[model samples]
Target: MGKKDVSISDSIYDRIKERVEGTGFDSVDEYVEYVLREVVEEEEEEEEPYTEEDEEKVKERLRALGYMD
Candidate 1:
């Protein structure tokens, strides 16, 4: 993977390092990337949350149209 050196404050680096100690991450860089990617994936999956009620409505409609029993 391509990498670029990012400038972070010593305090911020220390914070990440502390978390890294017990997280099983090999390095601070890996932990940071994992967190960033998690945030991105969460945003991508952000949409209407389907529920059982919604599913039942569709099934009811299909039954009404003789598409299902």
Candidate 2:
């Protein structure tokens, strides 16, 4: 596999190092890979929050359909 070097803050690097040791990962690269995978999973699972505007639209549709009195 190919590798790429990226720059990060000292604090972030330190935190990733800590996680690498704490999780018994062999290298910082492994820890970084795990973190990036988690971030992508979280982004995929995230959805827009429900809002009053959506509720109002649904209510209007229901009224138009005579489902509401």
In model 2, residue pairs whose N, Cα or C atoms come closer than 3 Å (at least 3 residues apart or on different chains), thus clashing, are none
What do the candidate models score in CA lDDT, each in turn?
0.76, 0.72
Q: Candidate 1, residues 1-69: lDDT per residue as tens digits?
A: 788877889999998898677445789999788778867966886795648997798688556534588
Q: By TM-score, who's the top model here?
A: 1
The CA lDDT at 10 in model 2 is 94
The reply for model 1, stretches above 4 Å from the true place, is 48-69
Q: What ranges in model 2 sit over 4 Å off?
A: 47-69
* Number of the top lDDT candidate: 1
lDDT of 1: 0.76
